[model samples]
Structure formats: structure tokens, C-alpha cells
Target: MNPNGRRGVELMCTGATSNSSWMKQLTSASRQGRHGRVLHLFFTSLRPGDRGAADTHPAAIPTALRACARLGDASSGRLIHGLVLTRFPSLASDAVAATALLDMYAKCGLVASARRVFDEMPRHDDLVAWNALLAGYARHGLPERALTLAIKMRGQGLRPDLVTWNAVVSGFALAGDDQMAGDLVRAMQDDGFQPDVVTWTSLVSGSVLNFHYDRARALFRRMVAAGNRVLPSSATIASILPAFANVTDVKRGKEVHAYAVVTGVEQNLTVSSALVDMYAKCGLVLKAHRLFDKMAERSSVTWNSMIFGLANYGHCQEAIGLFDRMLCDGARPDHLTFTAVLTACSYCGMVELGEGLYRAMKEEHGIEPRLEHYACMVHLLGRAGKVAEAYDFIRAMPLEPDCFVWGALLGACRSHGNVKLAELAASRLRTVEPANAANCLLFSDALASAGRQDDVVKMKRLAKRRRIKKLDGCSWLESP
Candidate 1:
């Protein structure tokens, strides 16, 4: 028979007896670079009367399943699972096929189904199965379950390799269980397993998440001292560099920068962005600007970091200017970029510029203004004694006004002594955030300012009844 005729005949054998022939055809199709066709042919062969008894081969179903997963075709994956159940339910007992199924389910975000397959496996005793389930749990944000599963795997006499340990450690780190992640690292060491780059990177990420810059630094130091020969990636440097931004110790931040240079990651986009942020937050905007300018390729995140850093340091004009430069450079501004720019405009009391930018954000850039943006606008209007305009803006917001938005109007009301506006703002504020002590205090202060002593007394009584303790105001100074 010709190849086409043979393929047609192959498609007609759907029963279990055709297992061997199906396996051979699958191999031939794969070798010929027709993976998708191979999957289609396999499933086509399994349809109703076409399935041959030779299709009972243990490896045929898994081969098809793997192909479906590789294609990322969820429908194909489900069809293969159905084929497995229909033609050869015994194939589910195959450890390799079960592992493949677990992987397919996990990749498709069907973790619950993956877990079911894992639980139903008669031979759930393998490390591969355990690792697959643990990885699924981690990927789906069930790190706690992943951790528990790891312990159970160990208890059940499965010797987890470095890959397994890395998964568990990374899972704990992502879940914000830094201490448990650290303990796992220590446990791995105790078990005579030398931690790899993945182990260190996971720990570093955990430190970054938990704001433990010092611990991250210490881990990096240890990695260097050991001379284990694994270099930190740009992503790793990016992850830890931001923590050093707010750090009082510029000396330490400089050390990390030096390391980035030594590791040849200084030109890395993420690392460069982080370095800019760190230097800016350390009151070294000039240095930040110098680094930013030196970058050959800058991402939008890089621009945002520099713009936000400038805005945060009270350099509103420069921040706005940088924002314009970002646009000139054709870097698209995300929501965060607009928030920074709007905040800068508010702080500088550039109401006209702020309003223009706000309108342009929606009209020109298609960016929807969020509550924070509205709050900044309200504050700007209130500062200029445009209380009525501010109130109107709140009412006209695309979404329901949040407590912060209402509080902005309340603050403006207090500043202008607009008793009616103040009462309206307060009533809306109370509805949105009833237990907010700041809102309550603002309302009471507004009542007092409006000469409503009886109302003020009543508000104070309500405040006392709610046991709302005033927050202490504090400030700090950093030596540059």
C-alpha cells in the first residue's frame, strides 16, 4: 500500500488489538516531524469501531498524551484522557503515563484534576509522582500543601533529588514562608545535598519578598565565598536590588552595584532599572540619572522607575519632564507611571497641568484613572479652594468613589470650611469605610470646624464607643 493508503488503514483500527501497530505508526509519524498529525491519527484510530486490539500497547497512549501536552491543546489532552479511559483503563496504572497526565493537568491549570490522578495512582510511591504533585501545588499557589506533600514524600522513603528540594524551597519562598524555606535549605545541607544556584536564588527571592535585604546579601556573600561557580542572573540581581533602595546603608547598595558590575550584569535592563531605583531612593538622583542614561536598551519599567523615583523625591518638575521624555522615547506608560505623574502634579500644585494630564491619560493613552488618581485630583482642587469642583469630580468618577477619594473631599471641606460639602463627604466616607478611625476623626474635626459642637460631641462619643485610638504621627531623617 502507498503511504496515504497505509495511513488511512491505520486510522480505521480503533480497538485494543491494534496497540503495537499504533505505536509503530506514532513513532514513524514523530520521526517524520508530523507530531500533530500523529496525535490526530492516534485519536482518529481510537474512534468507535476503528480502534484495533493491537492499540493496547502501554506506551501508545502516553506518547499521544505527551504530544497533546507539548501542543498545549487542552481539548486534545482531554480527548486523550478519554481515550485512555475508554480503550485501555489499565494504562492509567502505568506510572509513566500517570506522570505525564499529572504534568498535562498542571500545565493547563487543572491542579485539582492533577491531584486526583496523583491520589488515584496505585504506585504513588515514586519520586517523579511526588515531584509532579508538589510542583503543581506550588504553581497553583498552594505552597502550604506542596510543603506538606514534600514532608510526606520524605516520610514515605522517597529520596528527593535536588529538583524536588528546589521545588519545595521555591514554593515556601513564594508563599512568604521565609523561615520554612530557610529551614528546608538547612535540611538539604544536613542531608549532604549541596545546594545549587536554584536553591540560593529561591532564598534570595524569599528575602526580597519578606523585606530581608540583609539576609539576601548574606546569602549572596556565602554563594561568592563558596566559589560554587554559578553566577547570579540579571533577574536575581533585579529581584534583590529594590530592597536596597530604602536601605539607609548606601555603602551596602554600592557594594551590590559593584557586584552587579563584577558579574557583568550592570547592563542588564532589569538590573539597570533596579540600580536606578536604589540610587534614587538613596538621595542620589544624579547617580540614578547617570546609570539610566548609560543603559543602551531601556524597558518601560526602567522609565517608570526613574520617573517614580524622581517624583517620590519631591522633584516634580523633573519627574514630569522625565515622563515627557519617556513618551518622546516611545516607552508606553502603564498605570503606575500615570499615578506617579499625577501625584507629582498634585504635590507641585500644578492643577491645570494635572487636569490636562488626567484627561490625556484617558483620551490619548486609553488609561482609566483609578481612585488614587482621583484622590490626587481632588486634593489638587481642594488646595486651590475649588471644593465644589472636587466634589463634582468625586461624583463623576467612572467607578464608585473609594474611602480615600471621599476623604480627600472631606479634607478639602475642612480646609474650606464648607459645612455642607464636609457633611456629604463624611456621610459617603462612613458608608464606604465605617470603621476607619481617620475618616471618623476627619468627620469630627469637620463638625468642630463648622461650629456644630453638639454634632462634634456626638461624633466624639461614637469614636470613643468604637474604641478608635488615634495613630501616632512620626517622622524620620536619613543622613545622606
Candidate 2:
């Protein structure tokens, strides 16, 4: 035996059959301190072939089970499960321990093992087991499986409690299945389950994913009217706030901010970040800046959100200044952070700043420039009428440039009336996106603008041959 294993055996040999409470102390220490070694000692202290081990209290088994779960030691959990079987089979029958076992298996990513344990349980009446399985499915991105299991659970005459319903709703919302999630909410209401804050939050998050901002707002209103004591979490606020960004109705976004204040979720990091993003997206960069300044604590995500918000609203200088401040404040830039900063440079035609940041990202921060960063560079150079330089930059990139890069170049060529370069960029774009009506239309427009009527006619003929139709114009009206 290994020396450490031998030492454990030697310790066990001395106290193999002792009821001196040392075993109990060791077991308690393992549970309290989450020390796996103490548990090893406690288990080894049990006499070999001790038939009376099963007489241990059920409470002791949960403590051990919890220790195994916390440590995420599946082998220890399995061994403990066997010990429970041999010493106290009744512990396995205990609902709480069974749930613990299910949870342990789930946490270890052994959902199938958890399901087997669930199937073997004598009583399926345990709602905790059902919830554990639902949570397991949800955590693992098996939303459809979770939904199917939930339906089966209901079919078996088991009414889903609030936790079970929440799990299914959250699973669907996260999976981007807003319609199915909404249907489930309607079903829950039909089944006489009143919508709680969790339910409303789930619906709002799902609606936001589907870009149904109005529905999200309406649900928020209903949540307030219901007066359920269940408060909205920061996650709920974050999810819905971004939906208001693209909406022209700044008034609705302000209403959301007011609700956040009233509900006391405004101070939460997620909610605060969302408020900053919403204000910037709605063309209220000053409000966003004010909120950012007032935050007592800021995470990297908080800084990134403000940077992106400022960059998005054409406050490029302010964004660059904030980026510098973020670095000064010891916040490291993530990929999205760099993307925002690069976009800011692009918006302000600050090619030098963009190029410097790009180099710093690769050399200093060890972050490789992504396609978006390159695209931003292309847009920056193109906007400055350096079409040839932009084309060379795209050609020399480490990775293949996508249609966006070519499109940016083509737009630049059109602006500078470079017919030859426009044709070259459009030709590359056509191969990548054969059915792109916008590319054809833009190429035709460029040709016409350059007085190349013959080329324009030929391009129109190609569009007709490809059965590409020109886009129709439409406008949208947002509800106040």
C-alpha cells in the first residue's frame, strides 16, 4: 500500500471497532470543514465487514453526502452511497438524502446516473428529486429534454411547484425559446398557478430575447400589480434593459429605470450596467456617464458596458477617455472591451489610436485581434478615404476577411468614386454572398454614379438572372 494509504489503514486498525466518538468527531469535522481527508479517516475507522454500520442515523448520511457533494468527488460519493446501503439502507430511502444523491450526480455532470437513482427510488412523490432532475437538465442546456420531462411529470399527476415551474421557464428563456416559454406561462396560469415575480422575470427575459420589449414592459407592470413579495433579481433587470436600447421611446426606458429605483435593484451591478447601456443607446450619454460615475463598485463588465454605450452613440472621444480611465483604475480589457474601444476609434476617424490599441492588445495584453477588430480598422481606414490601404490591410490579415470587410471597402470605393476598386470589392462579395441583393443593388448604384451606364445595365441583368428583387422600403412606429 502507498505510505499515506498505509497510515490511514494503521489509524483504522487501532480504532476499528471503537465507539469512542473519534469517528463521530472526524465525520463532523469532514462535514463542517469540508475536509476530504477527515472523511477518509472516518470511513476507514468503520470496522471491515461491520454488519451493524447500517444502524447509523440517517442524519449522519446526509452530512457525509453533503461533504462528498461539496468536494465534487464522485468516487467518494459512490463509496459513501455503498456505505449507506450496507450500514443504513434506510438512509437511501430518506427523501432528503435521495435528493442530495441526485444533486451530487447532477453537479458532477452525471445526469444519467442521477436519473437512474431517480428511477430506482420507491417513491416518486418526492418533488425535490423532480426539481433536481429539472435543474440538471436546465444547467446542461437540455431545455427540450427538461420541457419533455416536465410535461411527463405533469402527466403523472404531479403538479409542478413554483421551483419546478421556474426551472422549466428559466431553461426555455436561456435557450432562446421565448414562444414556448410564454406558452408555458399561459399554461401555468390556466392550471391556477398565479404568476409570481420569478414567473414574471422569466417572461420578461424571454420576451427581451425575442425583441418583444413591449411585452416585457407589460409583464413588468403586471408583476407590480400582483404585489408578490418575490423581488426581481439583478439578472431580471439586466436581461430586459437592453431591449429598450434600440427602441426610440426613451420614456419607456426611463420608466424601467424608475422601477429599478423603486424596487431597489438599481444598485445591483447587473441592473446598474443595464441602466448605463440603456441611457447610452437611447442617446442620453450624459445620463449614462452620470450613472457610471455614481457607481460605488465597478466590475470589468461595468466599464465595458459604459465604453460600448459611449462608442455606440458616437461619443468616441468620451469612450476613449473612459477606456483610459478604466485602464488607470486597474480594470483589464476583455475582448468586448477592446471591440468597443476599437469601434470608438473607427467612429472618430482616429486611425492612429485604433492602430496603437490594436498593437497593445496583441503585444501587451496578449489578446489576439479578432475579426470585429479588423473590421473596425477597415471601416476606419475606409471612412478616411484610404481605400487602397484598407484593401491591403484586409488582404494581409492573419485570418480570411468576411463580407463585412469587403462591404466596408466597397462603400469606401463608392464614396471616393473608385469604380475599378468598387468592382473588385463587389466581385469578392458576390462570390461569398451570391444571393445578396444589397451587394448587387450597391454595385449597380456605384456603376450608375460613376456614369458607367453600360456596366449598371449589365449588373441589373445579372440581378434579374439571379432572381434577386430590390428591397421595398418600410418604416416602424414604436409605442410610447
Candidate 3:
């Protein structure tokens, strides 16, 4: 019988002693980015002398499955799992292979299939399989299920590992349950699992995901002070740098850069990009530019960071120049590159330049204009007092005009005191964002500027009736 599917493990395995060799071969294949070779090796290969039972060898399914997991090749993983079934004749009952299979399927976003495999397996008190299932649930946005499963796992006499604790913490963090996430960290400590750098890193990334920037920064500081055991890794530092940038805390961002240097993570591409982005956001475009120039290698992300940083600081000429350099350097501009350059054109009043780039985005790059790109264009036209042209552009939009598009138009109207256009923009904004009072206030101000006191009175009454509350305005400045 030729080797195929579930009945082929007898042909695949020769001896248990070959586990290390099998792993070394598969791991090498994975490192070389030979996912196809991995597939062929597992799914189509026949080992030496495996045709006879006298030459039978044990196969290492777990190691091969892990390589597949790392490469995100679930197709290869499933084939390996099928071979495990035939060789062991108890695939579902085997803890090691079952756990790996469960993890691979979960990471591939096939949770239903993962759960099916878990259910088919005979119940056991092992923690590895249980943790895999819990991680799958957590990673797939089923945090409640993971939490409940954690309780269930404990009831079955299984102890939670550091991964299990990390899953629960990360789940709560993603769910924006900061209190619960902190509680789990304490519980992990009480359970005798010292929080590693990964543990803190997860919390930091989660906080950023959930928009808790201040908390992310605090976690970064704690991670830095974690003694000799867990100094901030490049990832931990990279994660926290953006929080400081978001808050415009340039002083702290500088401190993070210094920390990265001492930790030897600053020289990494990811950390370097984050540093460039941080400096740019903090109004240090030149610093960001210098850092970009010094990098030995550049990815799309690095180019976008420098472009966005320059554009955001109103350095239209420099930003657009850098964009040209990026293309010359064989770096293809993404949607974000266009957005940044277009934003620079808007702030600098380079209308013709902006329009040409917009056309280039579609004709040259084949990238369609997204909402943000359109919004930037609208602001570009509106900021130049071309109220009528901006309004016509909004009318001709391929997609339904969203709040940001109309908001940009309304702001332009407010700037130029175009009462008629402002009223039109205000109507759309009110329909789309009824709860926002800024629209009403802007409309009233625009009407008053045009000496339409009665219209202003009516607008104020409308705002009062709707009970729309205005958001508080706040600004940040870096200290001297």
C-alpha cells in the first residue's frame, strides 16, 4: 500500500531514536522558508526500510507539528497528524500530538475543528492539551470561554502553566478588562509562576490594543525594573515607545530610546522603526529622518514611518521628496505612504501636487482610494477655500461619505465662514453623528459669523433638544 493520509504512518516512522534527526531536518526546512518541502516531506515521503515491520521506527509527530505551527502551515500539520493517527493507533489519546494539533488548528483560526479534535480525545488530567484549548479560545476572541475553561481545568486536577496564565491575562487585556487582567497577574504570581518578559509584554500590547496608553507605559516601566531576570526585550521596548508617542511624552520617549540602546534592541529594525515613528510624532522629523538614513536595511514599514512623520509635521516638500526617494530605492509605496504624502500636500496647500499623487495612487500603484485618502483630499480642497469644489467632490464620492469626510468639509466651511456650505455639511454630520454637539456649535458659529442670528438661535435650540454633549478639548506640549 502506497503511503497516503491516515494509514501511512507505518511507512513514515522507522524508530523513536530518529526524533531528534526528524526535528532537526524539519526545523531546518522551516528556517529556510521551505514550507512546500515540509509538506512534501511529511505528506509524500517514505522513509528507508519502512516497508517492512522489522525496520519500524518511531516518528516525532510533535516536533514536525510544531514546525508547521511556526510556519502557519495547517495543511502540512493536518497531514502529519493523520500519519500520527496511523502509527500510534491512538492519536486522539496521545497527549503530545493532540496538544500540538490543537494548537496548530487554533492558530489557523479553525477553532471549531480544534474543539472537535479535543472532544474526540479521551479525557485526561494533563495540562498541556487543556492549555492549548484555552489558548485557542482566548486567541479567537472567546475570552469568556477561556475563563470558564480555566475553572474547569482546575476542577479536573490540572495545574495552569505560565502559558495558561498568559492566555488568561491576554484575554482579559484584549477584552479591555484591566482589573481582571491585573488580578490574573497576581494570581499567576501566587500560583508560583514568575511573570516573564513575555507576560509583561502581553499586558503592554493588550493595553495598547485596548487604548490604555498610560497603562501601557506604566507596564513598560515595570518591565524595565524587573531586575536581571526580565529586562525589557526589544519587543517590550518597541511596544511601549508608541504609547509615549501617542501621549506626546517626548521626554519619556527619549528615555525609552536610551533604554533600547543599553539593552541592544535599538539596532533592530522593528525597534528602529518605532523610534523613528516616536520622534516624528513628537515633532522631531529631522531626528526621525536621520535615523531612517542610518538604517542599513529598510522595509515598507520603515519608509512609511519616516514619510508619515515628515508629513504630519507639515514638511510637505521633504515628505514628498522622501516618497520619491522611497520609490527610487525599490520600495513600493503602500496606501499609508500615499495618505501621508497627501496629508502633507493638504497642510502645505500643494493642491496640484495632491491631485497628481491621488491619480498616481490609482493609475501607477493600482491602490484604490480609501476613506482616509479621500478625507485628506477633501481637507486639501477645503483648506484652500475651494468650498464649492470640495462639496462637489463629496457628492461625487464612490462610497457613502462618512463622518470624517463631512467633518473635514464642515471644518473648512467654519474656517472660510461659508454659511451655506457649512449648513449643508452640518446636516450630514447631524444625521451621521447625532450625539456630537461640535457639529451644532460649529454651525451656530458659522451662522453667527454671517449675521444669521435667527438661524444660530434655531441651531442652539436643536442642540438643546437633542441633548448632544460636546467633547472636552485637550492638548499636549513637550516641556522645555
In terms of TM-score, the best-performing candidate is 3
Q: Considering lDDT, which of the candidate structures 1 and 3 is the better prediction for this target?
A: 3
TM-score of each: 0.67, 0.71, 0.77
Q: After best superposition, candidate 1 residue 33: deviation in angstroms? A: 24
lDDT of 1 by residue, 1-480 (tens): 111121323344456545466577887887776769878777787667975633655456666766766666668888778877886675676677777788778766688988998888776567877887888787667888887888888788887888888888888887778888889889988888877888888888778777877777777777767774766777777777766776646787888899899989999888998898889888888899999999998987788778877887889899999999989988888888888898788778899998999889999999888878888899889878899999888778888888888898999888788989988988898788877788878777878888899999998888889786777896544344
Candidate 3, residues 378-470: lDDT per residue as tens digits? 999999999899999999999999989999999999889898899889999988988888778878888888899998888878888888777
Error of 2 at 445 (Å): 4.1
Which scores greater on TM-score, model 1 or model 3? 3
Enumerate residue pairs that collide in model 2: 53-87, 54-87, 54-88
Q: How do the candidates rank by lDDT, highest first?
A: 3, 1, 2
Q: How many angstroms is residue 300 displaced in model 1 relative to the true structure, after the best TM-score fit?
A: 2.5
Task: Give candidate 1's error at residue 118 in angstroms.
Answer: 8.8
| TM-score between model 2 and native | 0.71
lDDT of model number 2:
0.78
- Tens digits of per-residue lDDT, candidate 2, 98-192, equal 77788878766678888988887767766778888987887667878887888889888898887887888877876777788788778777877
